[model samples]
Target chain A: SQQGEEDPQALSIQEGENATMNCSYKTSINNLQWYRQNSGRGLVHLILIRSNEREKHSGRLRVTLDTSKKSSSLLITASRAADTASYFCATITSYGKLTFGQGTILTVHP
Target chain B: DVKVTQSSRYLVKRTGEKVFLECVQDMDHENMFWYRQDPGLGLRLIYFSYDVKMKEKGDIPEGYSVSREKKERFSLILESASTNQTSMYLCASRAGRRALWGQPQHFGDGTRLSIL
Candidate 1:
């Protein structure tokens, strides 16, 4: 069973614009992580937000987690064509099992 | 940098044939995982190992089995390859330390398996 579900299965935005993707999970989590994957490639870790943390930033990426709401959001500022890829949110269950969401395909047009 | 290498980037096999998908991590991490990715189902875990010779089944372990003979090597075995087993296989590793939940998993390039 999938633990997380991402909204807006796909998103299209122009370069220099901000893109936001939301994810909601079913159960409590120890931490939430965001990853990016190019077509036909493995995933690359982007950022991680612990249950206690509400928000985190890494370069041009921002991640926010709301434990009470069991939701998280990823924001990419100043999107670039190279950022065109699928973004996924993974949640670590209390038992240590990691579950991933369906993912959000973001297209950044240059 | 941590390097998790999958044995093959692409593989073609026939149904009922036994297949082996190997993964090796150079970081000496103690945690290794195998997952399969489908179009809309996302990535589903097949199995995971926390240490050498210690294995656990994941969400989707029905048609898959995993082996962890060495600390750095993890292998996924298809006892009897089937058409439905064709998908993108991903291997990931992470440090097995305190607060393992806080660390991120490093993934390999993945293997696109096609079973006929």
Candidate 2:
């Protein structure tokens, strides 16, 4: 079963605009992670935010986690055409297993 | 750099034929996993191995079996392939808790299997 659900099944925006995706999970998690997948490519890990951390930033990517709400969000600043890909949020259970969301398809128009 | 390699990028097989998907990791990680990605259902874990010769069934292991005879290699076997089994299969590996630099799972370029 999937542990997280990403809102806004699809999104489109002009280049340089910021994109935000939200995710909500059913159970408690030790950490939450975001990944990006280009067409016909393997998933690449973006960032990881632990339960004790509320927010974290890496390059143009920012991730926020709210343990109380069992939710998380990923923000990509200054998006580029190359950012046109599928984004997924995964939660790491206490047992150390990773559960992924259905994912949101983000399209950045050049 | 950590590298995970899958044997085949694309494979086509007939229904009821036995299928074998192989995965190898260069990092010598302790944990290796197999996942299947479908259109609506994101990525679902099929099986995983924590050490050599140790295998565990994941969420959807009904028609799948896994083998871990060597430390650096893991294999997923389908006793009888079905059309529904056609999907993108991904392999990933990660360092165990004992590693100095605890890293996230590294994935291989998935194998797209078509059971006709």
Candidate 3:
């Protein structure tokens, strides 16, 4: 019973293009966070949007959250070959534990 | 600059053998988590600890166990390694909201374990 699930299992685009990944979760949450993983390494936190916040931005990364729909989307603009990685969305429940989505594999070809 | 460190980058173990994966965080975060990553299945949580000597089971905690004997250390244990258990193990730590507004977690490189 995974609480979060991401759409578009795999995505490919040219460098400098914009990539968008969406995540949907099944329960009430306090916050949602996005992370990026390179190869098989640990995840690097990218951005976090609270349940009360509708959108957030950090550099070229933009994240939008629709708590009413229990969904979120991450947009990476000006994608680079280095941006090729697995992206995951994690939901933090009121109980304090995080449930992660399966993840979306994004490949930015040079 | 929070630093989370894993003991090994890669590990190999024979089936039925015991395995231990260790993680340490320098920021003294109160929450620590252990997860295993596999193809298609993404990352599955094995266990997490909110404080020393406290542990909680995650979604897939069945063949695994965990220990948090110290504030900055968390260890994942496998009683009997199996081929199915071979995957990349990741550790993360986070401080509560008091420190910052939704502080992001810090992750270690990871331990790639292969059970033959």
Candidate 4:
């Protein structure tokens, strides 16, 4: 069974707009990580936030984690056509295994 | 930079044929993982190894087996490939929690396996 579920299965926006993707998990986790995958390509590491952390930033990407809600969100500011890709959230539990969410497909139009 | 390599980028096998997918990580991380990605399913874990010779089943492990004879290499085996088994296979590696430091996993380019 999948432990995490992402909302807005798909999103579309023009370049320079901001995009937000949300993820919700079912179990407690030690940390949460986000990844980006270009179509038919490998996954690229984006960012990770521990349970104790509330927010993190990497370049134009921002991530927020709310353990009380067991949810997290990824924000991509000033999106570009190159930013179009599928985003996924993975939860690492105490047991040391990662459970991934379905993912969100973001399409940035130029 | 950490590098994780998969043996093949594309593979084609007939039904009932045994298939092997190899992954090697250069960083000598303590953990390695195998996952399969589908159109809508995102990525599902097939197997993982925490240490040399130690393996664990992930969320979807049926019809699959793993081997980890070396600290830097992990192998995923398909006992009998089926059409349904065709998908993109991904390999990843991570150091222990302390070294990982809440960082995302490093992934291989992936193998596109087609079971006919």
Name the top DockQ candidate: 1
Off by over 4 Å in 2: B98-103
| Candidate 4, A40-103: lDDT as tens digits | 8889889988899999999999999999999999999999999999999999864466778889
TM-score, every prediction: 0.97, 0.96, 0.94, 0.95
Q: Please report how far candidate 4 places residue B110 from its true position, in Å.
A: 0.6
What is the Cα-based lDDT of residue B59 in candidate 4? 83
For DockQ, candidate 1 versus 4, the one ahead is 1
Worst 10 residues of 3 chain A by lDDT: A91-100
Q: For model 3, how does the per-residue alpha-carbon lDDT over B38-114 read when each residue is reduced to its tens digit?
A: 88787788888888999888889999999999999999999999999999999999885543425677899999999
Q: Tens digit of lDDT per residue, candidate 2, span A7-45?
A: 889999999999999999999776788989998878888
Candidate rank order under DockQ: 1, 4, 3, 2
For model 1 chain A, where is the 10-residue window of minimal lDDT?
A91-100
- Candidate 4 root-mean-square deviation in Å: 1.5
User: Chain A vs. true chain A, TM-score per candidate?
Assistant: 0.96, 0.96, 0.97, 0.96
How well does chain B match by TM-score in each candidate? 0.98, 0.95, 0.94, 0.95
The better candidate by DockQ, 1 or 2, is 1
DockQ for every model, please: 0.71, 0.56, 0.58, 0.63
Best-fitting candidate, measured by lDDT?
A: 1
> Candidate 2 at residue A51, lDDT?
84
**Global lDDT of each model?**
0.93, 0.90, 0.89, 0.91
Give the higher-DockQ candidate: 2 or 3: 3
User: If both were scored by TM-score, which would come out higher, candidate 2 or candidate 3?
Assistant: 2
